[model samples]
Target: MKNFKPIWLMVCTLALACAPSSKDEQTAENEETSIFRHQPLVTHMYTADPSAHVFEGKIYIYPSHDIETGATSDDMGGHFDMKDYHVFSMDEPGAAVKDHGPVLKLEDIPWASRQLWAPDAAHKEGKYYLYFPAKDQDDIFRIGVAVADNPAGPFKAQPNPIKGSYSMDPAVFQDDDGSNYLYFGGIWGGQLQWFEDGELVAGRKGPTDGIPAPDQAALMPKVAKLTADMLEMAEKPKDALIVDEQGNPILSGDNQRRFFEGAWVHKYNEQYYLSYSTGDTHNIAYAIGDNPYGPFVHKGNVLLPVQGWTNHHSIVEFEGKWYLFYHDTELSGETHLRNIKMAELQYNPDGTIQTINPMK
Candidate 1:
């Protein structure tokens, strides 16, 4: 007779083979619910370049709404064809983040053509103002303003772009004395390199047709005081210089420390902290200054490179603790499709920020 296994033994073996292991179950759960550190704040949609703020005891995020447009990625960021903006909010750390939905869109702006990039928001005179950047009809990036009564807005855009604005990224810092300043500018596809001698020379390029030489002074982020109304720039935009410990300008070739884009300014212990992205190097570096309009001294990096080609962030203090809000390509696995994340930001006793590694 042929050897045969008992029915009960055969059933047990088959059941064990079909069941998932504990490790496999955990992995599947994490992918579906994203219950882990540095996980996306909202997994339902892609968001990037988060500009976080604390408004009325809640955390708010203004980020670029990323969508796949079929445009290939290029050095000029052709694939970052974002067209709208969204507002996200949370009651506290580890709380459910709420998506406030579409607050602004390219079609609503009278002058905007394409590529609605990063944005920021501010509250003044009991009104909420939304500051953003987009390419106008001429294909040149210019900053614009929109207004709404609520922090979560269906903001109405101004009929025209900010008169003296150019390039991309608009971050507003309101001082203790009630003065508001706007920080902006970026190179490459941001089109900052096209401006020469304070004028737009469309064909003009930087040193070596890309970045400045090692010894040359690095490009500076621009800053301007906002008018009392917060609708116009009080004066012409000026360079907010970033220099070394010895007060020398940081060199462009020092890609690790130089500014590429994403200018955010926050004040802690009466000292101004100017943090930004070192574009090609993919690091979030910072500088320290005494005043809002900075000749900031290079400090160090706040974050290492994330999973995507770009890194943009915001620093905000809530309920006596500070946090860093940023983005990466963790959700979609595509550079142009990103998601926002947050981590607790700690500062040393000497007022320097502790470097954070996203993977950890």
Candidate 2:
């Protein structure tokens, strides 16, 4: 009986040694799961070029999905090879964000060849339209529209590209009068073109097009009114943004007020706020104007200089608060494979935006 008791004691010791305590079990569980916050917004996937809007009392964020390449490339060049778009939503700012998954993919658009870049969305006549820019089979980038009934969509791409827009980063802005304007173009390699009577016409082409770089104001963002169907541009394109009140152009050589790409416009308190990622894609600054077609005076910075190589963003008001949705490279550790991040945007008494702190 004493010998049997020793064997039983040995068995008990082995069991106790193998089993973890409750606290240890809890710690292990936490280490296995990641807690996502509203600050970085969408953690599970890499998202960039956020186009946020309020739909049906909830904020929906449409961002370009940046897929990580397992192997390193020269200068981290191939990291920006994004092929899809994702829509993330939440009821409140600090609440848990829901990833609605890939709403649109590169394969869905037959005309689209590869590079699917920054996208924006708008709702009209009970149908939601997603504006996206991608390269065609000829390798030229053009803007296209996808349709869906819901905000979180399995969006159907329109058969053809938007007739006139020959650029990237398509942002759709709808006015209070139900009139919508489509803003599309990029800084370096994008074309500045317009639409008139549903036909595409060339506007101010960029330096890459063999057209010498224009002066500051001539280098501003482009805007065009959309036709009633919300697919094609209704009128000729206009240089509606980044000019001065006296109708003067800003210069690219002037580091302070230079225009780069990622043009995002939103009206706040009767002031037309045209915020954009300035030249070099590291900082975001904005200007204020009295009208949408702006001679927007350069207000100070929106997002202070960030660590990432390309800092693109959108400003939106949700639940009576304003937030700046942008991207950084904190998670990917490389400049190209960036992730979306957000900060609370503040405004001054005169309706100018306060400088946002750079993300660490």
TM-scores, each model vs. reference: 0.90, 0.82
lDDT of 2 by residue, 1-360 (tens): 011223433455456557676867654543333222224676676778888999989989999988765635433133467888889998878778999988898988989987788899999988999999887886567899999999999899998998766768788878888889887766554543232333434553334442224442345677899999988998877775575546567665655666667888898888878888775646788888877777788877898766567878998888788988988765555566667877888888978888877632
- Model 1 per-residue lDDT tens digits across residues 1-360: 121333543455456556676867745544444323587887888899999998988999999998888877777788899888999999998999998999999999999999999999999987999999999998889999999999999899999999989989999999999999999989887877777645787555442354467789888899999999999899988899999999999997898999999999999999999999999899999999999988999999999899879989999999999999999876666777888999999999999999998874
lDDT of 2 at 346: 88
Model 2 TM-score is 0.82
- TM-score, prediction 1: 0.90
- Please name the candidate that would achieve the greatest lDDT relative to the true structure: 1
List residue ranges in candidate 2 displaced over 4 A.
Answer: 1-38, 69-79, 191-218, 245-247
What is the alpha-carbon lDDT for the whole of candidate 2?
0.74
